[model samples]
Target chain A: MATIGIILFTLVVTLAVMLGKCQKKPLSNACASFAFNTEMNNLQGYLLPQECEGYVAGYVNSGQYHSDFAVAIEAARTYLNTIEADQDGKDLIVLDIDETALSNMPYYVDHHYGVETFNGETWNAWVNNASAPALDAMLSLYTDFRAQNWSFAFITGRSKSQYNKTAQNLYDTGYTGWKTLVLRLPDEENLTADEYKSKHRKRLEEEGYRIKSCLGDQWSDCSGESAGKRTFKLPNPMYYIY
Target chain B: MATIGIILFTLVVTLAVMLGKCQKKPLSNACASFAFNTEMNNLQGYLLPQECEGYVAGYVNSGQYHSDFAVAIEAARTYLNTIEADQDGKDLIVLDIDETALSNMPYYVDHHYGVETFNGETWNAWVNNASAPALDAMLSLYTDFRAQNWSFAFITGRSKSQYNKTAQNLYDTGYTGWKTLVLRLPDEENLTADEYKSKHRKRLEEEGYRIKSCLGDQWSDCSGESAGKRTFKLPNPMYYIY
Candidate 1:
């Protein structure tokens, strides 16, 4: 009976020590990193089927993504209203094409919402088809600015080969009165999105256009030199350009 | 009876029309904006009691905030590992004090997780106490790098008046062997956080320190000229500096 008591006491003490150690080390770095990345990706609407069941039903199908887009557009409108446009009729609004003015959500949806690795062939096919629709909130913002004498310039990462198709889609999607739809030339194809966009913005400035505001779903779009007077980042968790 | 039937049919038609309008306009701009702001604020650990019940039981208390910090620090570690540190001993790692190095979580918890407007009196008192704890992940990173030859520089927005207290707190929190601790001078108080931080970063560069990586909780701390070779943005949604 005394030996049994001793054994029980040792077990209890060992359990207490283990519990104390666990309390001291609440979470391992690896565990925390994994949890954080998963949660962030899920919240941002870029979860994979393996990461979460019903991936489409999580972000795109759910109205949260649309709500976030609306919020961003509203904020942009507020900022734009505060900007005093120059009287020279040279006020330009720089916009990114994919996930900004035009949403390739349909293509992304088919491609596992960016969980699948990007395929140039599939992406080019989608762009060539050119049935992409204008993001509703962005389209609204575009329509409102069109009436206000702001020149709209779409600076996209799309190759110059798809210029006609992209232009047709833009016009079909009610993006009329755009000043210019700039596509990446073959030489510029190797440049990072920031570099490519910045070059065009500098050129636009040299051409006597004052970039009032720049809007895009990626940080690369709103970064780099000549990033406009104000830059608005729309949420895009699908893919990172640079 | 026939007149009553006609009235009922008209009522049904009116109800259907109203339902259709509701479906068409699922959420108003104001409603979406408010909801989006509240949701983002909650997720980022900046929430008011009026926005949600048991506000403190959210983000910070839920361990999500710490997990995010860990994830960011992990990413920084991964990035830092890829950089080939020059042999000159001029390779400096720039750090922001508040949130990045020393967490002001205890003080922020009392201040409703930043729902309360920043109070100079209470904030200074808390700073003068010299009791802020080191953010565990950042402190671990700092300790690991300290064993190596990487020089550390803390460029903070805190006024020079609280320099001694800040230093004392830093020392007490196991942060030693730092190269320099920079505090905002009296004249720099008027400058925005970005401007002030930028000036110091440029000065660091001129002083022959190669800023390899800059880690900060706010965008302002990692932006502007001479923002180091790479900037790692720590998760801080409590308050925006700019």
Candidate 2:
């Protein structure tokens, strides 16, 4: 019988790869979930203890982490109301550094990801395991957009010899207001760090400044031709890079 | 018949709550991945050109773009043998801007992962759909480490009001060399951007230079405290946050 139908198709593909590595969803399975904020905050079950410790119990037991933090706080309040309606000289917000700020998947499930076979001694033992925690209030609304003067940059993917261990793990995590860490020069040649953030935002829009909002966790940090000036998003289900 | 078996058990729990939106990948499958040096230069099995249509599917299909020139040539010869074993005087290699160099993930898969029902008309229709090509010999070795003198800094988490759309996305991608661009500080008290990159690597070890190496894609950019030095990881795997 064709070797018993190839041994029942190798036991149904090894039970579908052990059910996809035992998938997951038991933080008391409120039944996997549908969430888009569970019909805009109607939330019938759990997921709030600080977003169940910053999500991942199959997205808070299938709840989609409160509809993805209400769509990343409604895309950071529509990018702070389009940089407070930028009049042109003070209105900025561009952010995109590793999954849009912070969260490393417990260092890729404590070094299980391995990515592309890299090995700086098990990646310095997963950067000495500092442990991933923050995401709530995301550094106090980026320090209330630096008390509204509005200026923040972290644009990251990390290159140029990881500037002293990504600045000592963000100085041990406090994410102060922000200065301007852009990284990835490794030796440069006609720019590539997203075209040096689009020629440093066209030299701060010819030295006047209007950017008016751009955030990340990807989506081109504002979307192309070297993005920004009105885009905000944050809620990277986990790993990234495309 | 027991009310038709209780209406077939409420139609199998309403089809298991509408197929539970089938997850195991989808929040736009985190935007359908395909990177990690195009699957470690294997080009994820063919089909590229037309200026890399929908890109992120490289590893083999044809093979040409050598931006990360095979792990930046073994991480720039182990970053010039760790700055010629320390006594090499000037050793600067710090960077972190927009996903560790360049790559925004087609603006986060054109706004599907962010979700809150994505607005701004789907993020300006994915920024008028921009092109996403890069990795050119690791950006020509970051312009040969700024003509070999060796110095670069791009530190970012973007907050200082998106510094002109991150300097116009680094001048539309023709990035230039830099020394200072350390963001996060308008009463920065939340700190998480890797503790604001260990206070800008103690101001580059008090501007005495000799950083040796650091690079990223994650592991908090090689966690900090600056010991000896050497971190060159890449391959974001789409996203991470620990």
Please name the candidate that would achieve the greatest DockQ relative to the true structure.
1
Cα lDDT tens digits, model 2, A75-169, are 46644754453333255566665545556656654433222344567555554454445555555577666766677666664665665666566
Q: lDDT tens digits, residues B107-163, model 1?
A: 987876677878999999999999999999999988887776788899999999999
lDDT of 1 by residue, A1-242 (tens): 55545555555555555545544533333333343344222122233433432433344565756777777787778878777666566899999999999989889878777778679999999999999989999999999977887778999999999999999999999999998999999999899888999999999999999898898877678677777766776766466676
Q: Which stretches of candidate 2 lie over 4 Å from their true place?
A: A1-83, A86-197, A207-209, A215-242, B1-200, B207-209, B215-242
Instruction: Give the winner by lDDT.
Output: 1
Q: What is the clash tally of candidate 1?
A: 0
Alpha-carbon runs more than 4 Å astray in model 1: A1-57, B1-57
Docking class of 2: incorrect
How high is each candidate's interface RMSD, in Å? Answer: 22.7, 18.9
Q: B-chain TM-score, every candidate?
A: 0.79, 0.30
